[model samples]
Structure formats: structure tokens, C-alpha cells
Target: MSKKITLFAKIFSISFLFMGCGMAVFAQNKTEDENVIRCGVGLLSQSPTIFTKKTVSNVSVTASCSDTTVYQIPVVFHIIHNGEAVGIGTNIPDSRLTSQIRILNEDYRRKEGTNGYNTDSRGADARIQFVLASKDPQGKATSGIVRANGGQSEWQLSEQAALKDKSNWPKDKYLNVWVCNLKNGAENLLGFSSFPVNSDLDGLPTGADSTTDGVMVCYKYVGNSPLSTRYNLGRTLTHEIGHFLGLIHIWGDGFDCTSTDYCNDTPAASQANYNCNTTYDSCPDAQGSDMTANYLDYTYDACMNIFTQDQVARMRTVLCGSIRRKTLWSEYVPQEEPKSVSMSLYPNPVTNSNVIVAAVTDNADVTVFNAIGQKILQKTFTPTADKITINLPEYQLAEGCYFLKVVQPSQTKTFKVIVQY
Candidate 1:
């Protein structure tokens, strides 16, 4: 009698064997002893042929400004697990998720009191903040955290799409982050992120694939907890988010020093530094030492501290230049009671010049504040015949996020404006 074959069983056996070998290699590497950041950005650039295209093609470099523009990004965390209750096993508690968000904002903004904040002159407050989305994609109120029973104890890189599909919010409006127990076989594989594939290098539409858009993080590395010794500060997500915002490895994703990360500031290096050794310089031709403290490197979480000024500019360019990312922050117009006066600013996101047009019954005071709430410019305007135009020169103000407040006799109205040089 001819032997019958079960195709499904045979395939499962082969897959299990492959997984076993992968695990063996990972275990032998002693990844925990030496810090390793298994970011999938380099892997994504290799396959599918499309991701390899240069990210900044037609995008022109904006003049670096003393003040960095502040961008508010809405974030949602998707927790995937088997049947474990909240706060058990891979089903992390809400506090842990919230703590991760806190760490991200502190690192990006360079909050004064945090250990992540650096006093070095190169240290920069990215002026970027992350907040839990108050509204869901369906327009319903939400806590910004989605929980799904994936029915799987662990997941691999190949299963990212399956895990994300379990629960995904709109990528354009909110940054979706998935937290789950990654496959133990790939012990060093901490996390990965999909680059902004919504547009091509030339700023043309590439029809970004929604399924593979956001970020995937291992549950153990998601938060700053006592159990997570080396990576307890939650810098892994910070590093992955750097990729999400168009930052490559400080070594330029190559094994040689000839490669460049496209930023003028970051020094050239042949490889990533794993530990907190600040004196290691891999490139002889470079101007400065290796930037192991940079968030884009594979340094230990406690060692990572700053993002250079050039890096801040690069990220802001992606935020405002990329078609999908540019619209992340919707214009918020504050409502007010009916008034006889009307005030407005034209050429918003003003580059070279700006004019404030106002139709008012009386004189008013206008004040401008930087993103950090420091008053930058203030002037009182007296309208002629209920209308007047005021010209704002670009030389006086630096490129960044600002707020304009107009004080009238009846009430005070404030408007948000972006200045790009």
C-alpha cells in the first residue's frame, strides 16, 4: 500500500525545525550579555525592492533653526496576548503602557528632570511630544489602548501582520504601536518598525500599505520596569520611533565607514556601539567621536541621551514634507462667541514672510509664544477702518512651532502657527 502524506503536518514539522535552528544560533550568541538592538529597518530595506529607494529624494533641507518645531503625535498601543488577564504574563498592565508613553515624551522633549536629559551642548529637545489619543478611528471615545486575544502565546517577525491585524487604528491620524511576546527563538529581536512608505522618494504617492505601517515591540522591552535590567529605561521604543521618523542607524546601516546617514552632523562610524563606552571612535576620517549616545545607535538604554540639531531638522522635514505624515496634526480652531472683530494670519506655516489681517472695532494686543511657553514676540495693533495688514519678517523669528494670542476688549483668542524657514 502506498503511504499517504499529510502536507500540513509535514510543513509544520519543517517550520518547527527551522525555528529550532534559529533559536540555537540566537542562544549561542549570548545577546543579553552584549546589548543588541534587533531593529527590522535594515531587513525591510533589503526586501520588496521598494523600501530601498532613498527616503529623502525631492525633499529639500530646511535651514537649521535655533528653535525646533514641536509636533504633537497621537499614539495608540495595541496589546496582543493569549487568554491571560490584564497585568499577567505578556498581558501588561495599563500603567506599564502609560509609562512607555511618558518616557517617549521625556526623551524627545528633553524634559529637565529626567536622567535621559543631557546637559551637553549637542543635546537637543526634539520638541516632539506623544499623547494617548482621546478619540478612536470610528469617532468614539477611547483610552487609546486596544486589547486583543491573539490566541497565540508568542509571535515572530513573519507574523507581524497577523498580530497587527488583530487591532489597528488609522495610521494617518494616530501612530499605532503593537506590544506582544515576541518568539523566544529570536531572543535578540527586540522590536521593528515600518518606514514611512506612504510616499516615494520623489514626494509622490506610493500607496502605503496600511497593514505593515506602524511599530512592533517585544513586551519585555516595552516599559521601564525593575525586571528589565539593562533596557529598563524604555529607550527601545525611542530608537524604533527614530526609524519611524526617517532616521537610519548612526553608522548609516552599513558595515563600512564610507556610508552616510544623510545628516551633516552625525559622525561617520563603521559600526554600532553596544555598551556605554563613550571614547570608542570607529572612523578615522570622521570629525568627532562615534555618537553612541544618540538614540539611533544600539547603545544601552541608560547611555542613549541626545538627538543632534540636524536630526531634529530631518525628522521635522519628514513630518511636514511627507504627504501622509504632514496631515497628522489637524488644524484646531477654537470657537468663540459672536464678535464684531475678526482676526487671522495668512501664509500659515509661514516661510519667508507672514501678514496678519484683522477686521476689528477697536485696537488689540497680539502676543506670540514658543512651543515651550516662552514669550517671543508681542505687539499691539491699531486697525485702520476695521482692517489692517501687518507684515512679519522671517529674519526676526526662528523656524519652529508657535502660538499667537490676540487679546480683544471682549475676549482673548489664541491660534497655533508653524514657522518653517
Candidate 2:
């Protein structure tokens, strides 16, 4: 399947000033489990076919499908702290939390020039986007970030329910991410996520345990900040979210090449790679080398970069097939307030010419720009009754990525569009 690249809004610029701070140096004693074994190993003990059967079947059916639909998932960050004052201890500032969300969107969408961009041909734009929920579960206005004092200093992987119960929104409506101190026995764990458990072997409906259906991460590894150091760059959540979206470890959570992660593009490895070693391929018999750069690997945060094309298909299937996850993209659900106007552009990658159909509230201006932010076309149109169609000839645009900005009386929205011969 040819990956569909949908641009939303302008390119987000991420600052790397905090990257030079080095690994997180804490006063607590370190364990044999260094920075890489952060993700929980419990899920591996589940039905192995859970990741293989569902993912492989979905990928095969969608192999020739073009992902033109854009999925926007609402997220809620549950910040759990040890009764520390605001901006102190585990209660990280909202600025840091927001940066993490930005990283998720950029990495999943494959924004141009961002750290998420990979040169590998296997790299794909997932067409999945995340936005912080603007409304609470009760329909009250909120920033989507819930802060709570769990009364404890640290939370163990086994105590995920206790940490999540401290403050959790409806799991079906929002992607709940608990940020606090996470530990696996005596070792400090980075993060872990629960896979979408809404089906059985017979395709029967068997929902997952609601209390433990989200992601949990240590506060220090939450974002790309000075405190997060080595595991910074906000890839920890990206990796965990991959699990939330139904992606398993690239190594298939085994010590032998026989185990597979269900993706053909990723090479089999006997074990996970700890550091940024690109040349280390444990399974020589498999096609190609170990996909050390994949987000599903145990490689360092800075080294992990892309998701393979089949991985994208696997995730999209979970969103479309899961009972609860499927509701995230529902048109009936009320998204963020001050909702942007709805618009559509067809024959994307514009073969010869394209038609843009938009529901304009009033007089609006449409502007198109190339990948480098250069304006290529602009027009002012007053909708007859709330709709307008603009014809764009292929001769006017070179084959490349472009952005379409719509300026209306109430609000303005930007969409990424690709024009190709």
C-alpha cells in the first residue's frame, strides 16, 4: 500500500537545547536494568498470537489500501505526583507535557525536517494524529491534563491500577497516559502500555479491563526536557503509544529468530539492542538487518526513529477494529471547542487537476504553499450559501508536498496536501 501523507497545520519546530544535558543522574541507586529495559515485560507472557494474528491479517487485507483518511485521537495526561507543589517533583509543568504531545504528532505523521523523519524507504506516515482533549468527561472545559497527588512516592508496575485509579478519565473516549515514578521491583522502569484488548480469537467482543487500558510512564522520561536527559526527546511515550496501538517489540520478545513481530520489513533479532548500534544484526538468516531504528525496539531514545509500513497498517487496524478505539475517529463525537471548519480536497497527489470542496461559513480566503513555505496559489471566495469549490490545475503546481491554509471569519485551519504526477 502506498502511504498517504496528510499535512495538518504548519510544521512544528522542536528545540533541542536540552539534548546536551546527558543521561538522568538521580541520587537513587541504579539497578542492572539501565535506561533501555524501561518498557514492561509482563505483556510478553500474554497470548503470542494476540500480536501476530490480528496484525498480520489486517496488514494483508490493507496491503493495497491507500490511507487517505486522517485519524485524530483525543489524549488526556494524568499527572500523578507525591503531594509535591506545582512544577516540583513528579508534577511536571504543562509546557513539558505539551511538548510531548507535539512530538507524538510529528513522529506519527512524519513531518518534514523533524527528528521523526527517516530516510529509509520503509518509513511511513501513520496518518494518525493526537490532540489534547479540550473537554472533560463531564463535558466541562478542561486543558486535558489532570493533576493528582497519589500520596505515594513511587508506583510499581504491579501497582499500575493504583496509580491509574488516582486519576483516570473514560478510557474509551480518551487516551489516558499516567505520568509518575514507575518501578519494576527494585529497578526504575521508564514506561509501559496496555494493548487494545477488545476482541477474541473468534472475533467476538471481549473488552479489556478498563482500569488498566492506558499507558503509564515515569515522569522524568515524559518529555524532551533537561530532566529527561538520555531518554528524553519524548520518544518514550511514542514507543509506549505504539504498544497502545497494537505494535509489539521488533524482536518479537524472544531470544530466537523463529519468533516474529508479524511485520515482514523488520528483520528478526535474538534480542533487543540497548544503545545506538545500527550495524548489529542478531538474525542473519532473516532478510535485511535488525531494525534498530524502529520505535518498537529497546534502542536509546535519540536513536529510535521510524515505524515500518506494515507497522502503520497494524496500528490503523486496531483503531478501526477495536470496539472502543474505533469511536475515537467518530464524526458524532464533539471534538475540541471552537471546532475548525470542515473541508475536503480530492484526487490527492493531484494527477491532472484537483477540486477542493469546503464548507465556508462566510467570506474566506484559501492559500496554498509548497513544502518550504512558499505561497503558490491564493483566492478569495464568498460561499453561495456555505459551500465553495475551487479547481486547481496540475500545471500550476510542481510535484511535491504542499499546505492548504483556509482563513475564515471565525477561525483558520491548515491542511497538508501532496501533489504528484
For model 1, the stretches where C-alpha displacement exceeds 4 angstroms are 1-37, 46-69, 198-208, 330-421
Error of 1 at 294 (Å): 0.6
In model 2, state the lDDT of residue 190: 82
Worst 10 residues of 2 by lDDT: 5-14
The lDDT per prediction is 0.70, 0.72
Tens digits of per-residue lDDT for model 2 on 178-288? 999887666668888877765222221245566778898888887787775568888889999998877777876543566567777777765566667788777777677
